[model samples]
Target: MNGILNVLKPPGMTSFDVVAYLRGILKMKKIGHTGTLDPGAAGVLPICTGKATKAIEYLTDKDKVYRAELLLGVSTDTQDAYGKVINTLEVKASHDEIERAIKSFEGSYSQLPPMYSAIKMNGKKLYELARSGIEVERTPRDVKIHFIDILNITGNRIVFDVGCSKGTYIRTLCSDIGDRLGCGGHMAFLVRMKAGSFDLENALTLEEIKEMAREGTFEKMLTGIDVVFKDYDRISLNEKDKNRFLNGGFVGLSEGKFTPAQKIRVYDHDGAFLALGETVSDRNGKLNLKVDKLFI
Candidate 1:
C-alpha cells in the first residue's frame, strides 16, 4: 500500500470520488491522486498511497496525452457537451480546413481557462464561482501543445490525439479550434490515454481492483516509490555518508562532476533507497548534497 496505483478512472466519477473509493477499499488514510480529471472523462489516474504521497507534485507536473472529440456547430457555457447551449453556427469548414486549424495550435501559446474549472482566484475555486453565476476576468496562461494529430473527422465531429504540457485544457483547445473554423464547438467526449509514464493500457478498473483485494493479491499492482524518479540519476552513499544523510547532514562529494541544484536519487551502502538529494555549492565552493525528500 506504499506505492502508486495506476487506476483506470471511469467516467461520471469525480477525481476526489475515486480517491475516496480507494480509501474505503484499502482502509488507508494517506492516499491521494496525482492530478484531477474531469468527472465526464475516463483515463489513467495515478493514485499514490502511503509514503508515495510525497511524490505527488513530481507526478502531476508530467506531460499528458488525451484523445478528445470536438463537436462543431455548437457552443456551450462550460465548453463541454454537458453544459447549456449558448450559441450555434453552421459548420461549413472543409476537412482540410479543419485539419489545418487543429494543426495551427501545435506550439506554445497563451490559453484562457474555462470558467467551469478548478482554478483558484481570490481564495475561491473558479468552479464554485461559476456555480454561483459569477463570472470573473481570468488571464490566459502559457501552455505548450507539443502535438495535435487528427485521428478522425466525421461530419461535424472531429477526433484528435493531443500531447500537451501540464496545464493545457482540451475543452478550451476544442473551443479555440471551433472558433478558428468559424463554427463554435464544444468538447463532446474525452479520454485520457496517458499521464507521464502511466498509460490506460495497464490501469486497473475499480471492479478489478475490488476483485484483487478480495483475493488478497492487490499488492501485486502497486508500483514502487522509486518509479516516480526513474529519470533521475542515482547515487549510493557509503556507511558513513548514509548515516550523515539519514541525520539531515550535508554529504561532501570528493569526485564526479554534478551541476549545481541538480536532483538525484540517493541510496545507502546496502542498496536501500534513502532519499532525494540536490547538489549544491557549499560555502567554500565545494560540492555538497542537500536532502530534498527522505523516503525512509
Candidate 2:
C-alpha cells in the first residue's frame, strides 16, 4: 500500500474528501493527496499511501493541464461560475478579438490570486476572510501560462485547454482575458486533464477502486514511490555504506563527476530503495551524498 493512486476525483467533493474515502477503503492511515482540485472540477488526482506520502512535495511541484470554459460578459465575486455575480457587460469582442486576447496570455506573466482561493494572507486563508465579507490588499504573484489553446467557441462561451506552472490560477486568467476585451468573464467550468506525468486517461474513479478492491486487483493500481524520482540518477550502497547512509551519514560517490547539487536516488545492495540523496561538499571540501529523504 506504499505507492500512489491516480484517483479520478469527482466534482462536488473537496480534495480531502477523496483522500478520506480512500483511507476507509484501504484502511490505511498514512494516505494523502498531492494537489488540491476545486470541488467543482473533476479529473486526475494522485493519492499517496504509506511511504509514498513522503513524495507529496515533489508530486505537487509538477505542472498541470486543464480543460476549462469561460463565460464572457459576466464577472463573479469568486472568478468562477459558482460565485455570486458582481457585474455584467455586453459582449463587444468578436471571435478573432477573443482568440487574440487568449493568445496574449501565453508564456510568463504575473497574476493576482483571487480572494476566494486557498492562498493565505497574514496567516489566514484568503477564502476564510472572504467568507466573512472581509477584503484585503493582495500583491500579485509570478505565474507562468505555458499555453492556452482554443478548443471551441459558442456565443459568449469559449472552451479551451491550458498548460500552466504550479500556483497558476485559471480563473484569474479568464478574468484577465475578459478585462483585456473590455467585457468581464468568469470560469464557467473546469476539468483537470493532466497533472505532471499523470493524465486523466489513466485515472480511476472511486467506484472503480472499490470494485477492484472487492476483486482483489486493487494492488495493481498502486505505483511505487520510486516512480516520483525516475528522472534522477541512481546509486547503490554497499553493506557498510548503506548502514552509514541510513544513519544520516554522507556516502561517497565513486562514479563519474555529477552536476553540482544534483539529486540522486539511493538503493541498498539488495536492490531495495532506501533514500533520496543530494550531492554536497563536506567541510573538508569532499563531495558526498547527503540524505535528503530516508524511507527506512
Candidate 3:
C-alpha cells in the first residue's frame, strides 16, 4: 500500500475514477494518480499510494509514449473521433506527403490546446466552458515532440507512434498534421504505450487487480519507490549521519567530487532507501548533502 501501482486504465474512465476505484479496493484514503489520461483513451497510468504519493510530481514530469491513429479528410471540434464532425474533404495528399508533414512536427513548437480539454482558465476548466458553448482565446504553450514513427498508412488512415515531452497532445498533433496536408483530420484512436519507466507490458487491468487483492498477493503489483531514482548516484550514511539526515539537517560530505545541486539517492546504514538528496554548498563553500525528498 506504500508503493506505486502500474494500473492499465480502461477507456471511458477518467483518471480520478481510477483513483477512486483503487481507493475502494485497497481501502486507503491516501491514493493518487501521476497524470491524467483522456476518458476516451486507455493505457498505462501510474497510481501512488501512502508515502509513494510524494513521487507523483517527479513521475508526472517524465516523457510519455503513445500510439495513435490519424484519420485524414475529416476534422472534429474536439480534435478526436469522440467529437462532432465539423469539416470533411477528400484526402489528396500522397503517402510521402503525409509522412513529410508528420515528420515536420519532430521538434519544439508552440501548440494551441483544444477547448475541450482539462486546461484551466480563470478558475474554470476549459472543458467545462466548452460544455457551456463558450469560446475563448487560449495562449499557446511550447511543447517538444521527441519523435514520430509512422507505423502504417492505408487509404486515408495513418497509424503512428509518438514519443513526446509532457503536455504534448496527440489529438492536437493529428489535427495539425491533417491541416498541413491540406485536408482536415482528427485523432481516430489513441493508446498510451509508456509513461516514464512504466509500460503497458506490466500494467494490470482492474479485473486482475481485484483477483490479486482477493488472493492476498496485491503487494506483488506494487513497484518500489526507488525505481524512479535509478538514474541518480547513491550514498550510504553511517548511523550517526543517518540521524542528522532524518532530522532535516545537512550531512557533511568528505569524499567524492559532486557538482552543486547534483541529485543522489540516500541510503541508511543498513542499505535501506532513505530519501533523495542534493549537493549544496554552505556559506563557507563546504559541500553538504541536503534532503530533497524523504521517503521514510
Candidate 4:
C-alpha cells in the first residue's frame, strides 16, 4: 500500500474521484494522484499511497504525452467539446496547411490558459469565476510543446499525439492551431498516453484493480517509490550514519565523487531504501549527504 499505482482513469470521473475510490478499496487515507487529468479526459494517472505520496511532486514534474483530436471550424468556451459552442465557421484549410499549423507549435510559446480552468486568482479558482458568468484577463504562461505527431486527418478532424512539458494544455494547442489555419477549433477528444515513466498500456482500470485486490494480488501492480528515483546515483550508509541520517542529520561523506548539488538515492546497510538525499558542502567545504525527502 506504500507504492504508486498506474491508474487508467476513465472519462467522466475527476482525478480526485479516482483517488477517493482507491482510498476506499485500499482503506488508506494517505493517498494522492500525481497530477490532475481533466474530468472529460481518460488515461494514465499515477496514484501514490502511504509513503509514496512524498514522490508526487517529482512525478508531476515529468513530461507527458497525450493523444488528442482537434475538430476544426468550431470553438468552445472551455476549449473542449464539453463546453458550449461559441463560434463556428466553414473548414477551408487544406490538409497540408493544417499539418504545418499544428507542427509549427512544437516549441516554446506563451499560452493563454482557458478561463474555465482550475488556475486560481486572488484566492478564487478561475473556473469558479467563469461559472459565475465573469471573465478576467489572464496572463499567458510559457509552456513547451516537445513535439506534435499528426496521426490522421479526416475532413475537419485531425488526430495527433503530442509530447509536452508539464502544464501544457492540449486544448489550447488545438485552439491555437485552428486559429493559425484561419478557422477556430476545439479539442474533441483527449487521452493521456504517458506521464513520465508511466504509460497507458500498463495502466489498470478501477475494475481491474478491484478484481486484483479481491485476488490478493493487487500489490504486484504497484511501482516502488525508490523506482521513481532510479536515475539518481545511490549511496548506502553504515549503521552509525544511517541512524543519524534518519533523524534528519546530515551524514559526512568521505568517499564517492559527487557534484555540489547532485541528488542520490539513499539506502541503509541492509539495502532498505530510506530517503532521497543530496550532496552538499558544509560551512567548512566538507561534502555531506542531506535528506531531500525521507521515505522511511
Cα misplacement distance, residue 222 of candidate 3 (Å)? 0.6
Q: Global CA lDDT of candidate 2, please?
A: 0.91
Ranking by TM-score: 3, 1, 4, 2
lDDT per residue, candidate 1, 1-296, as tens digits?
78899999999999999999988888889999999999999999999998899989999999999999999999999999889999999999998999999999999989999999999999999999998999999999999999998989999998999999998899999999999999999999899999999999999999999899889888899998887888998899999988888898999876566778889899888887788899989888889998999887
User: What overall lDDT goes with each candidate model?
Assistant: 0.92, 0.91, 0.93, 0.93
RMSD of 3: 1.0
lDDT of 1: 0.92
The candidate that wins on TM-score is 3
lDDT by residue for model 3 (1-296), tens:
68999999999999999999988988889999999999999999999988999999999999999999999999999999999999999999988999999999999989999999999999999999998999899999999999999999999999999999999889999999999999989999999999999999999999999889989899888998988898898999999999988898999987566778999999987888889999999999899998999998
Q: After superposing candidate 4, which stretches have Cα over 4 Å from the reference?
A: 254-256
Residue 23 of candidate 4: its Cα lDDT?
Answer: 84
Q: Which ten-residue region of model 4 has the weakest summed lDDT?
A: 251-260
Residue 124 displacement (Å), model 1: 1.4
Which ten contiguous residues of candidate 2 have the minimum total lDDT? 251-260
Greater-TM-score candidate between 1 and 2: 1
- Enumerate residue pairs that collide in model 4: none
In model 4, how large is the Cα lDDT of residue 84? 95
Tens-digit lDDT string for candidate 4 (148-229): 9999999999999999999888999899888988899999999999998999999999999999988989889999899889
TM-score of each: 0.97, 0.95, 0.98, 0.97
Top candidate (lDDT): 3
